[model samples]
Target: MTALGPLPPTAAVRLVKEAVQDAYADYGSEASRWLDGFTRQGGQVFCGAGCFGCCNMPIRLSLAEALIVRDALNAEKLAAVEAHARQVLANARTAPDEDVYVRRHRLEVGYCPLLDRATGQCSEYESRPTRCRDTFSAFPARYCTEGYWESLSPRDKRQYARDVARTPGTDGELHYIAPLEYLSEPVWEAAAGAMDRAFGLQVWGDFWVLVSLSARPDFMAAVEAGDGRAALKAAQAAGLSHPMILEIE
Candidate 1:
């Protein structure tokens, strides 16, 4: 973790914002190429409206990405996101394990905070993080439902097999797709490096928690005063520690 010790608060934020824009632009081009290849190979994409299965699962984002999302929201949406984040953080604090907490949250909540309940679409679709953009399924949308995975108990492998057999649409197999896999190693490495350099730490965590924390006036103030480390620590203290930060290798 390289530290960019004390500078103006907006300096890092500006750098991160610029890096996020550049990275997402590159990611868009790379993702389009992958989709084109999949189509060329006669593969059909099943992701579309009313298919919010993937949204129910946890989505992580870099600090820079989260900041961008925060900047894009209006007052009303930001308030809703804050309320949702409080619930998520409260739930996470009581769970015995982070993974279990997230799984249970998905089962109970069943949608991302950023998702529009009425239309079943992302509110900030244009500025969505790479994690959302990269997610796709080679199988039909029905097979991708969270219920298929969440309903099965860990002890019931046989029951799981039977359930899979009973499920229609899928050919009793799962083939998930991630366009990031097809991106060049150098491209990903550059993106990762850019995030690390901009944020001082190789920070990545749950999108909802990150966005909620980023929307905080105090957190932004701390970061603007050249104390992003303190802002992140405050987030951790507030139960935003799950999906812990990772090293940019």
Candidate 2:
């Protein structure tokens, strides 16, 4: 309700708690029963603690995810979010051309502004992005480092992404990254990119993540109006080359 900013630690905790409580009222009891059944039915696996590994991965999220994140962020916490954006921009500007892909593969520097460093856990763990909540390790039987892709060569990683995006039959998966190379689905990507352009979060990353973030009301409005492209052209006309608009498919 209050102006969002960099929220204080206590405030962040309170927001997360409130959100989780509301969700519990809606689905918690049923979902918990299901999870219990899943665990009992030989679904239990890794039990590592203090694993910041998964938090660092370039996990894609939906626009709803960004809204949830923004809604959870208190006034004080907004500062941290803004700072993160600034830092990302700075990194992009200074990175050498050849190293551009390499830099992106590296884990985002520093703990997420949303994390509680003292506990080494997400302060909003309960209300964390759905992708984070849903993803599981292929080898849950083994304790694997979560940000495993950080070690991959940029070219190989991009190629793999392309393959996944081009491959068929993954609509049922809870979380999957967009393959950058192949374009199996065009209209979806274009619309998603338009949404990203509307939001001013046009930087290339995970397509789904960008599209999901761009689905914010404001972003959706601009994109649906078909004026987001106009805005881009105007920005370019004003001498801003390479504006941070979404990459259209």
Candidate 3:
């Protein structure tokens, strides 16, 4: 916090990643033990390598994570990201709330840019954003598919629940690996602190929204120079500031 003299977005990303590295590692170890204990009690984890059904939705992230994503992408994937971001941005333009945005983005905007459509796998699996890494499903992969879940009637849901090792949350969402979420929280906290110290404000939001902002050298420069207005102006012009899509505060 002491030496924050106009650091570049890249520098901020390093700070964020480094800040969370050990915490993430600890979370992984704890999560493994927790999973072992959980499954011993007849619980289950249905998320697997080929299950990319959860990828087709709106997800939030910090600018530093976005930069990691930008750096990880190739030219083709970069273009794909921009294209997907445009749809996400467009969907945000009229979305009444996050729920609507998530559903619309899932069924409308469709799969993630990095998703391998044929194999139902993430191409950038290793360097994927925090949100992607955070989300996990304890239910059958088909349950993770929003459309399939939506098609189930109330009675059908009840009947299915009777036979499943359910860990239902507030929204009937099956509890994902609970420990996985703990790891991502520190990353967000570190990213928020790093962004705040570097630019005097924080940029956090939907993954594509952050990616759009991160890829723009002008946007990056504006924030690096502590020019929030210019950065906000640029992002707004591109329709990336819908409250659901992003927050530059």
Local accuracy of candidate 1 as per-residue lDDT tens digits, 1-249: 111112233666777777777877887887787778867877667788767778887666676777778778876667666666666666666778878776777777557777887888988998787677767766567656756765657766566556545443234544455434445343345545665675444555667776776665565565445465677666666545443432121
The reply for model 2, stretches above 4 Å from the true place, is 1-34, 47-50, 90-108, 138-226, 230-249
lDDT of each: 0.64, 0.42, 0.71
- The TM-score, computed over Cα atoms with residue i paired to residue i, of candidate 2 is 0.48
RMSD of each: 6.5, 10.4, 5.4
Cα lDDT for residue 156, candidate 3: 85
Looking at model 1, residue 147 earns an lDDT score of 62
For candidate 3, write residues 1-249 as lDDT tens digits. Answer: 011112244675666555545444655676677678877877667887778878886777877677777777766677677778878878888788878988899989998878998887888776676777777767678877878867999998777666454463212334455556864687777777877887788877888767766776667877777777888887777555666677777
Lowest summed lDDT over 10 consecutive residues: which window, candidate 1? 1-10
Residue-wise C-alpha lDDT for candidate 2, range 1-249, written one tens digit per residue: 112332222332233334434543344454455446656766442434454545544444333244446556555665555455444444445556635623453444434667776766777776565445544432232223434556658995776566545433223231232121122233224324443444433333332233232323333343234555653443233222132312322
Off by over 4 Å in 3: 1-10, 20-23, 160-175
Estimated TM-score for each candidate: 0.75, 0.48, 0.84
Clashing pairs in 1: 9-224
